[model samples]
Target: MTDRSFLDWPFFEAKHRAWADEVEAWAAAHAARLTDEHDADGSTRALAAAMGEAGLLRAACPADGKLDVRMLCLARDILARHSGLADFAFAMQGLGTGAITLFGCEPARDFLADVRAGRALAAFALSEPEAGSDVAALATTATRDGADWVLNGEKTWISNGGIAGGYVVFARSGEAPGAKGLTAFWVPGGLVRVVERIEVSAPHPLARLAFDDVRIPDSHRIGAAGDGFKVAMATLDVFRATVGAAALGFARRGLDLTVERATSRKLFGAPLFDQQMTQGAIADSAVEVDASALLVYRAAWLKDQGTPRVSREASMAKLHATEAAFRIADRCAQLHGGLGVVRDAAPEVLTREVRALRVYEGASEIQRIVIARAETAR
Candidate 1:
């Protein structure tokens, strides 16, 4: 119901357009039952099951083990427009299982079938209390013990934390310092304990996990011991552009709400749309939305076209789209006046939900740094 005209852009193909329409239709049909507004964990579980049953999770795990970045972006964009929670549910499934799809051994690959089927939920455990954007600061350790690795440490801000069936956990395994010593492991969720459930301004199934002598076989290790950083970066590089696409969804929805309010509401003996200020806000939001779409699809397109890594492009897209979405949401809230401040009002809720997108999956500041580094190197 928002604007599908963006699909006509050259960045997408006929198949991408068809897939986008299908996802939008699916989201519309299922949005009402897909999320429980009051229960983050419950809603995530239910949404995952529903997405699995619909075979939508297949986009997250293609048969060839190579994810279609364009399809991923299109799906996230459409789903986020319908429901932020739905977008979160879908994004986490892809992100949580990404390392496995990209670098896992046979056992890790076997888990993908259950994950895609929604019988098993997946979690990506990368962030810790001290290590967030700074991956080199991670303190978690996985020590070798004969055929198994004993994992001991804590991971925080984990999506699908308490509810996930398995986790892709990164920890220090070698004597080398910094990211070079880190390794990625596939740990069964039952082996770890959730220390605390986190509640955000926008509800999500986030938690802190503790690993106390948890043992996973060497077969569960993803990539090489020193390649954890590469695996995590590669996984992130692929999905980061999709984050921008999700922000575009939120911005599109916010702009639609603002347009409705502007056209229907009256102020100073005239329709709100007649006011220059309202017109400027709408125009600015539209431009931002289009700009966001351009950057998001550009990154996705580049990756799909065989660019080994689109880190710089992905960072720029995420940085701009998330920041622009936040601004657009704020403007929409302002245009709504007192109605927007109502706790659960559409614009208010969107504003709150979009706020977190700026911080997660590499914060805006980190994105700036990445861009600067890339530009300077060029």
Candidate 2:
């Protein structure tokens, strides 16, 4: 069965355990959204609305602005185990408004409640065609015009791009050069147009967007002109571990589904579990699932404890969990034989979803560099 055993670990508080129970029930109740193949945009919007109605979106926008990293991790773990699309909806709500949650003034933070309530959607517009993981290479520019900022550039691979009511955009504001020259702003979607829609193996409203001299008052800026890098990195610090948690969920689900299949599927007048070869595969995946969980929760616990700048821990968690989860999905798919390759199969779906996780937020190579740099600096 689905493991609720992680909730008892010391990484969680009593209230967190109770909250996990709630999310588990909610996820089970909405099993229909487990697959995100058809009409991804509509599915994402519907999932967000459902999660908002259930009050789960509150985790994405805590009233205190001090997000409980443990809660965020647990919620993502549960929801991802049930439906990755649900996790996507919940995660984007937090990530899309993460700068505001971290640095926005009262005026900018005003619309967060609307996002949390599902009345509006938000997108994180940082990656550009030339700058997927290289944040400094982004060509988007926001020029100062009197008291206003005028944006002109393009952003690609943006989640919730077209449907979002607003976006958290990062662009070069020329404070210094390279990374330091960036700034964060809140741009309404009305000012930007979706130029193209990009589809992946697992779909989720992916798009490319363009801004042509879109003007906004200075109030929309998320932080000071020179602070965009800090704002983006800091926001990533809060959500990075949760990405690991999502990967962990996928790994655990992979393990469970494989086990269920192995125990029931017969080969040569015996269950697949009776084969030592099958047992070896399942055993290896089980160990990986636990290892992934430990790394994921440790990073989250550290964040919740206010150990600021968890770049090392978060990177390690995300790197290992995503890689291991994909491996586990691969193993499970192999064990499933021909069924795994069929459209919409559990292993097929997970392999696709986990593959994307390694590329987004930061690539696996980027995360490895982040972790190694942190370690060697000591």
Candidate 3:
């Protein structure tokens, strides 16, 4: 069990606590199916359907267009404690439809409805081969036609790339130089072709997408023209902290596994816990887990309290928690000896699951840059 005491922190409300309990209870009953090692796409699709049926995905994009960051964090933290695929399914629903929730026209809003219901998958296509961290250098082009925008470019590292029902694509519109010259579109999956499927340590429906002169009606545009950068950043801003929450969950689970092994596994004619080295490892893991929870929840609380933008806080949370979670997971594997290296073992699974959280959304190095820039600006 995770340290549920975090629920009592003043950062959460009675409602947030209730939501967490609800998700936790639901996960306790249904986690086996969602967590099993099925094919990546099959399992992800199954998770989407199951979570949607449970009404767990409704919070991802609410009808009122008001996102409760705390609720999002709580759900991700709890679900991630159970399984990373569960967290991925839930987070993508929010992230994939985030722009539509905030700035969708009627057609895009309809798509958001299906995503929230888990009838379809959603994806955010913002990165290109040459423009991973540099949003300004995006080369995808969106040219104006009479009633449509012709899109042409390649997007790599797109989550739900082939499986998603629709994508929120950012393309350069030449509104101005660099970051200013961009537009966002809600392109249906029918117009896309998968260029390549990306296989990562943790399997997911990741792929490279090629948009060859695909056309979306002007009505599918999100935010103002040339505001694509803002839309992408805003969407990322809301969910960045939740990335840390997921990391916290992974770390907490690792700590629990470590504790169980240390107290029961024998070494040198005594429990492994009797070893000074093992005791020190346990103590450090506990400290990192708690510190990560504080940072993760603090960022969520700041966003929920209506901080205009929480880039700095969110970046700090992502940077520290992800970095700490990886370290803690590695330690979990280390303490488990050779069993940790065995495929499908708890420690090995967890170690693989968490390796990507640091790189996706925003890389740790990018988080550092975001923090440093914010501080220097302050």
Per lDDT, the best of the predicted structures is 1
Task: Order candidates by lDDT, high to low.
Answer: 1, 3, 2
Candidate order by decreasing TM-score: 1, 3, 2
Stretches > 4 Å off in candidate 3: none
Query: Each candidate's root-mean-square deviation in Å?
Result: 1.0, 1.2, 1.0
Please write out the lDDT profile of model 3 over residues 72-189, one tens digit for every residue: 8888888888888888889999998888887776787777778878899999999999999899999999999999899999999999999999999999999999999999999999
lDDT of 2 by residue, 177-282 (tens): 9999999999887888889988888888889999999998998988888899999999999999999999988888899989998999999999999999999999
TM-score of 1: 0.98
TM-score against truth, every candidate:
0.98, 0.98, 0.98
lDDT of candidate 2? 0.88
| Candidate 3: residue 250 Cα off by (Å) | 0.6
Which of 1 and 2 is the better model by lDDT? 1
Candidate 1 stretches greater than 4 Å from native = none
In candidate 2, which residue pairs get closer than 3 Å at backbone N, Cα or C atoms, i.e. clash? none
| Model 3 global lDDT (CA atoms, 0 to 1) | 0.90
